[model samples]
Target: MSRLLRILFLTLLLTFTACSKDDDSEDGGTPIAGNRLSTGDSARDFLSDENFDELVIEVVYVEGYRPTDAALNNLVQFIEERCHKSAGVELNVRSFPSPNIAEFNIQQVDSIEKVMRSQYNLGDKMALYVSFLDGKFEDDSDDSVVLGAAYRNTSFVIFEETLHRFSDGINEPDRFLLESTVFRHEFAHLLGLVNLGTEMQTDHLDTENGSHCNVESCLMNYRVESGINIPGMTSEENIPELDSQCLADLRANGGK
Candidate 1:
């Protein structure tokens, strides 16, 4: 069927292309992920620790092009609960408005630099992009883009699609879990991790040593498409404790 073909197409594209997303509300949003962006070979400059107090997150919800409300709420709660229960990091999230998402592209790093020039000097503290990146996979991998260059040193932006390829369409709980899972997946990236890459490489998954992320009950696994669900409900149990550096950042600065 065409739908089956579409899913296959999307899977292939996503394996190669990074994606992004945004919610449509003022008080909430979700984080999404795409391909690794090469901000040239240069390392990013992070704000000094003294500047942590000035780091203000300004979320630009790119609505029209993605699933706006329901999906994002699930993402927000998942991150909040997971971070609090697992790492004790309390993230402060706020949402703003934005133009069409289709117009944004991963290569357009300069637009992100604009956020730094604004009144809040937000570019120095936060990255801006749509909220839809809360992990919903899309049939069209190119439909969205995220901008993180300005805050690349301290943070990154993920733009995800609205529709989940496997949400079972209208089943509410399944949909919620779909978004939540992706939200966790993408946010994990903010902490800096890498994937195994491609279907062929999946055999590298270490199921017995508890070393590979592909474990069914681990927060870091991405094999849900095969019905491998991580065991716990709350993130604290599902995910292991944060590494020292991440925990230090979470404890000291609060996952900002």
Candidate 2:
């Protein structure tokens, strides 16, 4: 072939290959609008094997705010027990430099996720993003501190710095216990607990407290995320579990 024709052919081949590669890994290319949906919007997908058979939890924490290994393991176990992910659940955890913000709102948290998160829903594998920040949530108040929040369908944030202040101290819960509880609770929101997305099997929604369950001992209880509730709730060796009503809702929603 002529030199000019050969050069043009090579360029065309390279361009076509790049475009094909991008189309094949569309989910990993960039954040999709579907991923930023409201919390609970993807509950059925997470709970059932209908849409996604595998679960990938992308855990990103700020420097000095990595979650305890025990807590992360607990989170995986919790997910396996509740979600029907026949392909299994996995966690990709890593840390980044602190944003240096004293407190974060949902918007700020979302922005961080956009920049730092690597996993996204791809084919039969669903992705969840969990951020452990060094600061507190902006909505935290002196009387009612926030521990974590599930802001998007597959995203949540844990105020790890605030959790450290409340745990592993005199008369306080163990750090792993507190972290595990918050992790499960926030993840339950993604599963649509307490009428968030999955329909409630019973009227156990704590209407006075947003999408939380009314059962005081339930993991989805509104107080579970409050600093005041930690000491009292963690008196037992085991962290809180979803109440029967909540479990019923999960079963109805295609969960195991």
Candidate 3:
């Protein structure tokens, strides 16, 4: 064959190979419209087209801030069951326990973001991070107790303190309920419930906080005050679930 023809053939072959690789691994998930803002609607849109491969959720915790076996199992079960039933995506969850760290005051989200990005490398999969850190989350002005924080698709719960508070003089079941409620609530945010990920077909968002739903009974309500409802935490069976509006959004946004 002529040298010129050989060069042309080589170029064609390279192009074909590149296309094949992309076809195999290209993210099948839908892209978010406009700027990638960390809004409830945007997050939902990002995960709407996740027909790619597997949905991997990484649960990380400080050595001293881990949940009980029952709590952890319940968390995994809730996540796996909900994702499979609603999103039709296969779930792969892995947990990593980091060495205990003494300081727990997170001044900003970047502190936790840095740790998450460095330790857990989530390559191309549809990934979310759940970090269990010690102490309470604080800002410059206020030092109120916080259950967790979610940005984009990552969430970290300062749960050790809260768990200790709830279980201070309670039984195992009560403690499990507290942990499970917090666990599911954070996961709900990641799922874009209550007009977070995808806009609610109806108006259920609590515009006041801009992250939680207006419904009092919904799991995404922003009233997760530490000791507000201790009696409600009496049973593990009473863990929160997504309200109908959130479920509709999930279904419309490529979830089941």
Candidate 4:
């Protein structure tokens, strides 16, 4: 071929290679959206239409602790259905054995620290801390101590034994939210879809829990997101489902 023809062929090849699908291996392999942004995004920024892929997930359960199999099943189902995940990676739901509850909690804290320190090496991007006990007590009285916690690094909790989740039919068990609902909210946090109001302050963040957001029937609307004006279990009506815009926000955030 002539020199001009050869040059033209090479140009086309380079263009095609540049447009190949993004594995989203950047941002520590967190699987970011097609675009990354520093400013907050609106509900329409990321949603359906754009290619969405599910990042690999890893969930660690402190062994010897019995929360509920229902919670586990619901959580898995939630991630599978809601997120734009087209299925790229596997979520490892792990359970480590520990006989001492006190010792285990301390270890859990330590493990979280380690994960943060070595985030560069770990895959799956996010990890969760799910518990049914208070730092002091194992019963309802102290359950109010803290409902949930997240470190903005995919860290948080769900008190399965809290008065809200208690079997006492009278209590109505708001805290014992459907497993899928809880997972949807937390995963959104890592994806940067929701804000963590204050460290260790469950009430600081926006939640549908026991309020109007739930009535909206969106995943972002959990009963816990309930505000003063919002009613309890408001998500019952709306469900806070994430639309296309939410998916875009996730892509730009590197999907913690």
> Candidate 1, which ten residues in sequence have the lowest lDDT sum?
6-15
| 125-188: candidate 3 lDDT, tens digit per residue | 4545556665544431123445555544444444455445545353323656667777777666
Runs of candidate 4 exceeding 4 Å displacement? 1-54, 82-84, 97-145, 160-171, 174-178, 195-256
Scored by lDDT, the top model is: 2
- Residue-pair clashes, model 3: 9
* Number of the candidate with higher TM-score, 2 or 3: 2
lDDT of 4 by residue, 37-58 (tens): 1212211111222333434444
Whole-model Cα lDDT of every candidate shown, in order = 0.32, 0.77, 0.50, 0.35
Which residue pairs in candidate 2 collide?
none
Query: Which ranges in model 2 have alpha carbons more than 4 Å from their true place?
Result: 1-31, 226-236
lDDT of 3 at 101: 45
The estimated TM-scores of all candidates read 0.41, 0.85, 0.66, 0.45
Summarize candidate 2's per-residue lDDT along 32-84 as a digit string, tens digits.
65566778889999989999999999999998889999999999999999999
Cα lDDT tens digits for candidate 1, 200-242: 1224344542222544444443333223122232232332333
| Clashes per candidate, residues 3 or more apart or on different chains | 21, 0, 9, 40
Give the candidates in order of TM-score, highest first.
Answer: 2, 3, 4, 1
Model 3 poorest ten-residue lDDT run: 5-14
Better of 3 and 4 by lDDT: 3
* Ranked candidates, highest lDDT first: 2, 3, 4, 1
Superposition error at 72 for model 4 (Å) = 2.9
